[model samples]
Target: MIWALGIFAGAMVVPAVAAHASVEDSEVLAAYVQARAADASGALGQSARLHGAALALDPNNKILAARTLRQAIAAGDRPLAVQAARILDKAGELAPDGRMLVMAEALRRKQWKEAGLQIDGIEEDEVFSFLTPLLRGWLAFGARKGDPLAFLNQASTNALADAYAAEHRPLLLLARGKKEGVAELAKAASDDRAHSQRLRIAGAAILADEGDRKAALTLLEGDLPPIAIAREQLVAGKKLKGAIDTAQAGVAQLLVRLAVDLNAQNAGQLALSFARVATFLAPENSETWLVTSELLAAQDQHEAGLAAIANITADDPFASTAADTKLKLLIAAGRQEEALSQAEAAVAQPDADADDWARLGDLHVRMERPEDGAEAYGEAIARADSAVPGSTPKWALWLMRGSALIEADHWPEAKTALQTAYKLGPQEAQVLNYLGYSQLERRENMEEAERLIREASRLQPNDAAITDSLGWAYYLRGNLIDAIKTLEKAVQGQPADVTINEHLGDAYYSAGRRIDARYAWNAALVYADEEAAVRLRAKIEKGLKPELVSP
Candidate 1:
């Protein structure tokens, strides 16, 4: 189950200190300025390097040391992080993250006592309090002193902490090679509320290693692409490597889980910090790298993100996920051509699945090649049909293909696809809305279109696009008063939506409110694409055409 945690506040802003006019001060200031700029641009490695340089010039600067420690950890520069952590610790300004870096180093050196002290020193805030017990447990396991399970099982009021405990207990047990680990893992995997894919994969790997191949296969029984890949590997007699086979790897897994949870909550920086630490601890774990790459991409560090995922080879279980992430990163970087090329290459592979073809279709649509998109989606549909014979048809794929066909002006083909989608998923609001709106635009089956739109509106009352479709249907039926009212509500829901605003403009002009019509048209023009802008400008200049309105 997904658990919500309170977001940690960002790093404390360093108050600027007035520096005496000197050559050294000027050099330090220049480096500091460059560091801030690099940080802003997501050049985290360069930022850390620059910050370290500035700190070297002014070693007594506590704020600079803190910033350096943070950026160093963020950049996955362990040596730099350790240096900055030492500086911060000496000055008694070490934050929890700095302490974490030091603790991580302690763990690496097998200094269990030092790691425990560092964990103890961490102020029990929302973020660390949740982790403190887990860290203690891992440290105990590594030291072979205390009962790690007891530390993990310590009851907590926080449900999220308890959930984490349930996940980690089994992992720690497995790491110790205990037979009970398999049963505990199976039990944990069966608890849907506390279930994790990591647990299942780990359990499956352990079971396979212990010759319980059937149980391993059962553990990974799912249609998800990752599960499928694992199952195929198992069938081929390949031993699936478990994520956590040691105390250090267990700690890394814990950090990776926290990183994922924090990223889900939109805490990108904090997530990156955790992910980087995990990477440092378990560089062999491709999952940590994947999380690191995704978090980097989210922060607009596309190049770094790509570089991070490059570590995952073609045979890695995470390769597919990495490829998908790479496509997104390329698109976000405005390298759509590169993304399109990758998508093409992916679908050209002999074993390419429906997902690969669908990705190509999506890329084509993004490039405005609607006809190509429709063709690619058709291939995806064929593959999907072959993959699951006589199963329920994939309504979503048909809907996408239909939308692309409509964009390409293949009306008959579009209608057939949309009808197929409606047949498969009549209750799906998106399918209903797309089919209804496409028919409305063509002025075909007007009565049926109205019925479909009304049902779609009922299913998704807050959806501005569906609401606009309903409003447009009213206008087409010559109910100008109701049209204006409904269209106004649609505009309120999405004021900047070009289609909604333009629809409102049309309704206003049809109702003889010329001034309101012009205002709405102008608003739409502000946000419209080139083609829509030209049309909106014409409507603003001469009002709606007489023949376009219902009599």
Candidate 2:
């Protein structure tokens, strides 16, 4: 069954349907497309239903068939996937779909031999080259059909063109109980700096097995991300990296994964470490440095984060991006002047592209340098307008300029920029809240402001600033009780956040919970600076302390 996703109001994109069709059928098809396109990762069942519908309608379409098979594989529906692949194989073009379908089914059923047999028939053709064989090597090792390390080493060398396969080979060998093979395979795959960490890890694992605990401990503590197979590698033999090249290739591979998924919280620390390793391995990989900086900034490690981001010189592939990130981080870190100056330097560089100018202007706005930021933003806007379609980076500049104008108290100009930001990224919670808060603070467009703030709150339920805004919005409408409850929840989630505590205290006082309010106020004072704490003490003294409620 093809899966579908629930519609998202923030995701304004209409699902693209198959070219043209009858009006009635088109609407139904569009709904299916829209459901499939919705960002519901767990709605695989729904997405599968849509794909199935499309496949049934266009049974002759190879791409549609392949898509269905892939979806089935992802959903772990082996019977459905096998059905699709068998049909494709009958169609005479076996483009890896059937191969993976068989393997996936075999893996699901734990049929190790049949799984190995699926990829075995195509062993000679380098053109049939894929990662399936390397995966099979793992299955074979587990089955004890051959020497695990030797099998993986030979298969991997033949399939080394794919970077992912290359990295997995050494680990697979470790899994198969071959310690010395690790060092040999590591040497072959060491040309890519992004992969060096895996090689080093494999080497260390081999040594630990030989009872060289101290040597293994040193290698295990090395900068590489921990791999599950390291334990097995040590069980095999003695690890050695005395001749390992620290500057080997493939060290940056981990950083690349993080860059592809910057919002992945679990990968944040590992990404930062990989970025550092990449920076150490290949100082020339400026893009890796920028990715590192971006990850740090996203994690709110601003000071050192900005330092990582700002290091990208103009010669790098993502120089403008790095410089732009640096400006944002500086602003986020509250080092506004430094952000402004950094922007200035970026725009001034001789090789600085038009993007550099726009990015610089946006930085100015973030730093509260309105005139300069506005001017720079305008240059970027003009460049974006003049560029080829899909090439103009207009929307972000427009939004930044608007934010800058808001800071400058230029109401009309700010509104225009805010609207532009909406057009570019309609679902952005921060932009929605910011615009809504501005309108509320100015005491105009009250209804629209409330709606926008509510929407923002829905999108970011746990965000401290958004939660505070929702509570305040409620307060504005005389919903004092709701304000108190909402603000208190926000405070609880972020106990260390001064903003949340202050807002909660204010809401409590407004709702006539004077004693409860006093306790919150006192707590805030305890975490405040000496001068700030002194002033807070007055509020704590004036308010009554409420009695504890029994559960």
Candidate 3:
């Protein structure tokens, strides 16, 4: 059951302090400035190091210590967090988050009582109130002290948290070999639709473990989503595993859930540390590995992300998604050959699905193999059609096929597929943008193209790409005034976009603003693609070609 809870923890901002008469520490101030500069430059590790040095030089400054701790967390420096935590704790200034880190450390060490004590020190807040009992319940179950259901049942005050507890308690019960809570779990599974899929999957696991395969299959057949379908397939095919059974795994699940909360708050590196701890506790859990890899990638640690994704074994239900993620990371790291090889391998697998073929097509396109890309996209469409038979294939799949065909210069087939996609998803901005832009480039269906481009602009008013298309459509229709106004907006919204700036330059020249046109072309050269750069340089040297100049 996906008990999706959104509890955002706002980051604490440290206020900067000027050097006081009594605290005239030049070294500390200099280190602080260096740390700030490092943070602004995206050098998080350097920031963390400099902040630590500053904190060491001014240990008594609570604000500096707290800032250092935050930087350390962002850099994934556990030892540094511990060092900062000690200073905060000694001064009785540790906040709820600082306490949670200490609690996680205690949980890691299997010091149950110490973990409980740390939980007790958490400042009473909305999340704390919900989390406290849940933590205590998990501890009780782990420690064999009291009924987990009693503490879990107390979570009814909040609907979402209650749903989480309801979904969580059963997996723990089955893991511990207790059947007394089966009835309650079944009821909880039917309680809320938001989390029902995960609950049903959990229920199926429990039932299957108890040798009730028929009942388990029944649960799996009801209103199953895609992820649940994966679980159902694994369960029916006898490839699924039993529920999480260890105290460590239980704690890891808690930490993973907490990591999700932190991710929602955009605390990527801090969330990575929590996810890493979860993986350390339950190395076989594919979910934590996926999250850890994504967090690593978000922090620009591509190699580390690949390492985490590598841990997803073929037997895991998440393996395909993990493979796809790994391939993208490889491409991002400039290992296009490696990524293409991986994509080729995936499509060659006996059971590769339409999605796998689609991914392969994308990889080929990225590698600049347009013919191969067109062939792969065709195979994907064929597979999808064979799987679903005659229903309007996903608009996105058709859209992708259209794009590939366009790159291959097969205009008739490309136009057919794009029209099909546009018919299916008439209101989709991207579909409107691509089809309209393509028509503009081909200099056909000028009136229809203008309507489609204008509709796209209305749907996505802030989208610079869509605005660029609208401006281009106006330029093609000889509406120089409207073209100039719209292109200016597009350039303002995306000043660094080479194509948008080029269009703006064209609009300016057509409107007799030759000086502004030259300035825009010069700016476009800064970020232009090779072809665009050539065109921009020609325009700057001799102005727009005669036919393209103002009448």
Report the number of the highest-TM-score candidate: 1
Answer with 1 or 3, whichever has the higher TM-score.
1
lDDT of 2 by residue, 1-551 (tens): 22223444212333333433334546545544654563144344455566666666655556556666655544334455566676676686545435544544554455767767655643432333544445555565546576543544555455333445555555555444545545546554554243344455545544554555555544443222122224333444424322222212222332344333433556564444445544543455455566666665665566656656655654332344465576787788888877667667765776555566777766665555787777777777766654422222466667777877877878898898888877776687877888888787776888888888889989888887788778777766778888888877777777776555655676677678787777777777667776656556656665523321100
lDDT of each: 0.79, 0.57, 0.72
lDDT of 3 by residue, 204-304 (tens): 66666677666666555542232354455655566454245556666666677777778889876668767876776677766677787788778776766
Q: What lDDT score is found at residue 300 in candidate 1? A: 83
Runs in model 2 lying further than 4 Å from the true structure:
1-252, 255-274, 280-288, 291-317, 325-354, 387-393, 423-425, 522-551
TM-scores for all predictions: 0.73, 0.45, 0.59
Query: Model 3: which ten-residue window has the lowest total lDDT?
Result: 1-10
Q: Give the candidates in order of TM-score, highest first.
A: 1, 3, 2
lDDT agreement of model 3 with the native: 0.72
The predicted structure with the larger lDDT, 1 or 2, is 1
Q: List residue ranges in candidate 3 displaced over 4 A.
A: 1-98, 105-110, 123-129, 156-203, 218-237, 242-247, 348-353, 367-371, 384-396, 406-411, 418-551
For candidate 3, the clash count comes to 2
